[model samples]
Each structure stands twice: as structure tokens, then as C-alpha cells.
Target: MRRTHSLRTRLAFGYGLFFAAVLVLMSAGVYWLVRQALLTEVSQELAAAAELIQQDFAASAGPLPGFFSDPDVLLKSLPPRLTELDTPAFYVQVSDLDDQFSIGSASLRGQQLPRTPEDQTAAMGGSTTTRIFPLGRGRVIQLSAPLLAGGAVVGVLQVAQSLRPVDQTLQVLLEGLAITGLIALVAAVRGGVWIVSRSLGPVNEITSTARQIFQAADLARRVPAASAADEIGALADTINAMLERLESLFTAQRRFVADVSHELRTPLTAMRGHLELLQRGVVRDAEDQAEMTADLLREVNRLTRMANDLLLLAQAEVGLQLRCAPVALDDLVLEVVRELRPLGEGVAMRPQLAEQVAISGDRDRIKQALINLVANAIQHSPVDGTVTVALDQDGESAYLRVRDEGQGIAPEDLSHVFERFYRADRARAQRTGGAGLGLAIVQWVAHAHGGEVLVESALGSGAAFIIRLPLSREQETEDRG
Candidate 1:
């Protein structure tokens, strides 16, 4: 198995790493700038001391021969500040061009200041130069300038300063930066972890809720509402909505299974009873045997019809594609009315086709939908009552309405009339009312043609089912033109 870390841990780590990098860069920059500034200050101080010595030499009478002849006079000619024995900051030295003779500051304590060949060459060339040389344990900055007499270079004067103080200052700064950076890094990491944990709290809750729902097999469980209207809240809302849909589907599935079992069991039981009677030689008379056989055949047909309806619904559920073509809506309605008139018994079917409309759809599916709606109306109508079928159109769509003179559906049941295996009159005889998939099939047909089916009814008045379908492409174009 691969190892994994929590989002909070990863986010906090990244945040801390970024902060540390920035902190390190900032500290390094400050250290470099301060080091440069301190070194520059030291160089300027050495240059000033060397300048004062050169000015003193220039002020003296006959500088080159007189100063070279007497080391004491030469040492005394330097700036008083540079010659201080107690001041350990600056060291001043004077040497000839070949470096054969030299005199140093009292602070040097008989030690000679070291001079490099490059500094000697530069000083002989009459160019002032500066260089750093390692001293006893620290370092020193040396500035060498030409000693001139009568506009001629004769020797070199070197001014140097110890770098111990600069080094000590930088070391202290480094230590402070390290300590401060460490403390800030630790605090930033802790604060980042806390912030990340707070941000992901909702995600943790969602995970826990989903886990519980999975283990318990409960689709009705929902993720808790988020406190803030953020992306997490939107996610929770979406998941809750999906759960609600799944729960509805699961409930419907269970109900469908139970309804199918009951519907199948009734016909199967009737057939079995009739078969048992015949086998026992109970119906000996020819007429009685024929009637029993007809009854058995009726039950078998009912079962077959129920099976076919279930098959159609299954096909629709699995996204069955329709063979679409231009269908004459008025003609199809008339055909369905004529075919189901006998099934109406004493109820009359009156098709008030006010308009001849054409639509694009699967003719067979549309015919089946029409038959189901008309038959359903005929079934629910009172004896000798009228079942009115109307065909009409507006600018963009055609409408097929079927109205029955019977007890209207209750307001609560209207919303669910088109659900599979749902019947308002649950106690109605199965043989007469069927398995209640008719309205569902009608709804599927209407939706498949980019249309919708609607119901208008109230208790005890009557019921009207209207299927609205878009006009055929050619008809719509002609009308628009």
C-alpha cells in the first residue's frame, strides 16, 4: 500500500517551506548588505588616514630625501590619531619603493605591516590601492599610496585597520537572524497547520458522514449543512440533493418489486386453481369446461400484457432509442379511439380534433401512448359517461388532451400519477385497471419527443391529461416563413 498524508499536513508543510525560503533569502540579503556597509566604512576610514599622511608629507619641506633619511621624523609626520599607541583600530606604516626600509605606527608594537607584491607594484606606479591581508587571528584592510617629492614617486605609505570588530558584529547579526528565523518558522508552521485544519473541517465531516452512510446502507442520510456558503457548502448541497434522488429511486424500486410480485401472483394463482379443477375432472360438462378454459385464457392474457408492459418500461429505463419520423397526430388519435371504443364498455369516446397537426416522433410509440391514455380514460369514466379527446395546437406545439367523467385525482396524488406502479385507486381490481404503468409510458413517450405531459384535476370533478409535443420541423419552418 502507498503511504499518504492528510491535506492539512501537506498544505502546512508547503506553507512553512515557502515561508522558510523567503525568510532565508531576506536574512541573507540583510547580512550581505550590512557586511558590505561595514567593510566600506573601514575602507573609507583607512583612505582618510592615508590621505592625511600624504597631505602631511606634502606640507613638509623636501618630503622624499628628508623623510627617508630619518625614520623618527617620518613616523612623527603621520597624523597624530594614526600614531596613537592605545588605539588598536588603525596601523600606519611607511616603506621605500623596494621595501628595504620601513617604520610603523606605535600601535604595531615593533611588528611590521605585511605588504603584497601587487600593492607594492601599484604604489610604485603612483596609483593608490587597497587590499585585505590575513593578520594574527583576524584580517586587516591596507590602503597604499605613493609618497611624492618634487612631483616624483619615492616610497609608499600603507594604512591598515583590523577587521575584528566588523567580524564580531556580523557574527552577532548571524546568530540573531538564526534564532529569530527559527522561532518565526516554528510559529508560522503551527499557525499554518491550525488554519489548514479549520479550512478542511467541512471536508472531514463530509467524509465521516459518507462513511457512515456506506456502512449502514442508508441513502436517506445527508451531509450536515455547512456553516459558511463556500465551495464546501455547495458540495454538501449537491451531495444532499443526489442522496435525495437516490433515496426516491430506491424507494420506487422496492415498491415496483412488490407491486410486480403481487400483480403476477394473482394471475398465476387463478391459472393454477383453474388447472387443478380441470385435472380433478370437476368441470365435466362441455359448456362449463369451455367457460373455465376461457377464464384461464383471460388470466394468461392478463399476465402476458403485464409482462409486456414491464418489458416496455425496462426498455425505456435503459434508454431505448425511437425510430423517429413525421407522424400525423390527428390520424393516429382517430385510429386509437376507434380501436379502444369497445373497451370503453358503456362510456362514449368523443374526439374533438380541432386541428390537424403533424409532429416528428416514433409512430408506434405515439400510437401506444394514445391507446394507453384513451383506455385509461375509458376505464375511469362512469357508465354512459363521455370520454372527450381533443387535438389542438398553438404557435410552436401540438396538444393531445384526454378527459374522463369520473372521480378526479386528489391533489396529493396528482404529482405522482405518472410514476411507475403508482395508482390512485390502490384497491381497484387489477383485471380492470391494469398494473398502473400506462401513465408512465405516456409520460416517457411525451418526453422522448421533446415534450411533456400534464394533468389537471381536483377531487370528485374529473381528470384531464394533456400531452404537448413540438411541431414538426417542416411545419414549424412553414409557419415561421
Candidate 2:
């Protein structure tokens, strides 16, 4: 089975890995530079030793007749120890032009020094050549110089040094780099884990808060905002905002369920009571039976209307599917006002319509919205109150305003008037209007048409609800079609 790591583990591991990679690269660079510096110092020492040996050979041969002309004399004069003291293990050898070794260090005596093309070239041209190679259990560097007799090369002198000390130094540096890198990697992993854990602390709290909310089924629970203005803080704030919305929705849902049950129960209880009376033969005459039937029909009609309103509200909540077409604003408003004239009773309705003003929207839905507003206005109006339905336009938008001389909405209820099943005066609304879904439907219709509904009202004064919709560009085409 594969193991999956949490976000914290992944973050820390990634950070530590990156840090370790950088440290390894730096350590490798340092090791390379140290190795180069050690090799350079070794080369410089070899050069100095070669120079000293050449000088001594020149000094010892001056009184004698060109001592390099004799390999035996040259061999006897060469010093075994090239440096003063404290120099590392050293080797020296003299070879004739024919590649036969004559003398060497004690460790290399009777052993033939390795010959190379560079040695022949150095003997012929009187130049020095240096090379490095592996020797017994370690490495060595050899510097070859030509011996000269009256400007003619006689033999070659080669000096070599064991690289054991340099090897030992570099080995120590490698060990140090490995040890230090390991320590740094461990420190980086721990530090990364701590920092990551600290940074995600608020996120962990958010997770815990969410879990608690889910377990308790409480939408009101919120995570405390982090103090720092960082991503974590932003996340916390966002979660809190979401929780607030969730709480509002849950509260609204509970209220809606209670309201629907009460509304339905009232009509059902009335129907059941009337049915029981009819079953018990309480209606004795035709007139009494007719009155009972009318009362039952009215209750049934209320139920039917409630069911329709609920269905429409549910559809609007999901999304209102509008049958889009060009609708003449003035004519549609006047038509809705005429249909609601009977419901207005003693209220007066006046139309202030502009000529040829049109919009692109669902005609039926728009008319329904106007009807609801008109009915609401009529219901709230006093006897002989004037209800005005006006249609006008600006350059970009058309407006439909419904004003009524009625006791206007309370300030606190104005914001919630468009919420489903919300009623400022439940008793009055139930008596005269619907199940409190009319205003919500009106708001939905306005929004579906890319318009908005705005209401201005104060208690004991009149109220005006204005529907603002953008004008259609293809009005002429729609009219012609």
C-alpha cells in the first residue's frame, strides 16, 4: 500500500529537500575549490624543488669538466632530500639518454622509473615536464628536467613526491563536508517542519472548527480570524463569511418550513371542519348548503393559490426559464392594471404610459410581476386611495413605477420584503394578499430580465415600487417581426 502524506508533511519535506540540495551543491563547490587549492600548492612545491636541484647540479659541476657529461658523477652529486626538512616522502632518479636508470631514492632504488614521451622530449629540448599518476597505495607527482652539458642534453633528472599528505587533507575535508551537510539537512528538516506547522496553525483551527460545525450541524460556528494579514487570515475570514451565509440560509429555511406548515394547516383545518359538518348533516337547507360549499371552495382556492406560489418560488429559486420576446412596456403595464382593477375595489388606479416604450423579456412573467405589485398596492391602499402605474424611459432604460396612497412599509421590513414567505404584517397580508411570495416573485422576475425592483416607503406615508429595465436594441425588428 502507498502512503499519502498530509499537506504539512509535504510542505516541510519539499522545503527541506530544496534546502538540502542547495547545501549539497555548496559543499561540493567548496570541496572542489579546496581540492584545487591543495593541488596547486603541491605543484608549486614541486616546481621549487625542481628549480633547487637544477641550481645545485649547475653549482657542483662548474669546477669539474661538465659533470652532467658523466651520469655516475651526476648521480653522486644529487641530494636525496630536495627540501630542508619536514617535507613529505620524496623520490629522485637519474636516467641516461638511453632510458637506463642510474640512481634513485632508497624506496625506489633498483626500480626503473616510468618513462614517457615527455621524458624524451624534455631530454632533447632541455625543458621540464611534470605528470601525476597512482603509485603504491597512494598517488605521486613527478617532475622531469634535462641535464645539460655545454648546451647538449646528457641525461634526465626526475623528482617525485608522495601525495599521501594531500590525500589525507582532502579526505578529512570530505568527511567534514559530509558530517556538516548531514547536520544542516537535519536542522533544515526540523526547522522547516516547525515553521510550516506554525504557519498552518490557523488552517488547522479552521479544519477543527469545520469538523465541529459538521458534527453538531450548527451553521453558526465560525473560525476565529488569524491575527496576521496573510493567506491564512484570508482563509479564516472567508470561512467565517461563508458560515454567516450558511447560518442565514439555515434560519430562513427553518422559518419557511414553519410558515408553510402553519399556512397549509389553517386551510386544511377549515376544510376538515366544514367536511365534518357536512358529513354530520349540519346543513339543513339549500341556502345553507350553498353557503357551506362557497366557503369550502374559497379555502380550496387559497390552497391551490398557495401551491402555485410555492411552485413558482421553487422554480425561481432554481432559475426562472423566461420565454424571451420584445414586450411593449406601456401596453403591458396598462393591461395588468386593467386585470387588477376589480381587485382594487374602492381604490383608484391611474396609468402614466410613454409611447412605444419596449423591452426584451418574458411577457407573461413581466405581466405577473406587475400584477403582484399592483395587487399589493391595492391591498395596502385605503378606500378611495389612488394607485398610479407609470411607464417611462431614459436613454438606456425603461421604468415601471407603482405608487399607492397606503400605509407604507416599515423601515426594518423594507429590506426583507423580497424574501420568500416574509411579511411585515402577517395577519393583514394573509387576509388581503397571498402567502407572502408575491414580492419575491416580483424581485425574481426583475432580476431575470436583467432589471431591478426598488421601493421607497415610510410608515403612514405612501409607497412607490419602481421596476427598472434596460431598453432593447432590436425593438424595431421585434415590432416588424
> In angstroms, how far off is 374's CA in candidate 2?
1.8
Model 2 CA deviation exceeding 4 Å by range: 1-16, 43-132, 141-162, 196-205, 355-357, 393-396, 473-481
Cα lDDT for residue 309, candidate 1: 86
Estimate, for each residue in 301-325, the C-alpha lDDT of model 1 and write its tens digit.
Answer: 8878888888998998899999999
lDDT of each: 0.87, 0.83
RMSD of each: 5.5, 5.1
C-alpha lDDT of residue 47 in model 2: 76
Compose the digit string of candidate 2's lDDT tens values, residues 1-481: 9999899999998998899889989989999999889878877877787777767765555445535467677656665444352233777776667774466666664554586987788667977887888877779888888865445566787778888988899899999999989998999899999999999888888999899999999887788899999898999999889999989988999999998998898888888998898999987788988888998998889888888988998988888689998898888877888888988889998999866788888999989889989988998899999999998877678889999999899999999999888888888976863788889889988999899999999999989999998889876454446
> Which residue runs does candidate 1 get wrong by more than 4 Å?
28-171, 196-209, 218-224, 231-239, 354-356, 427-433
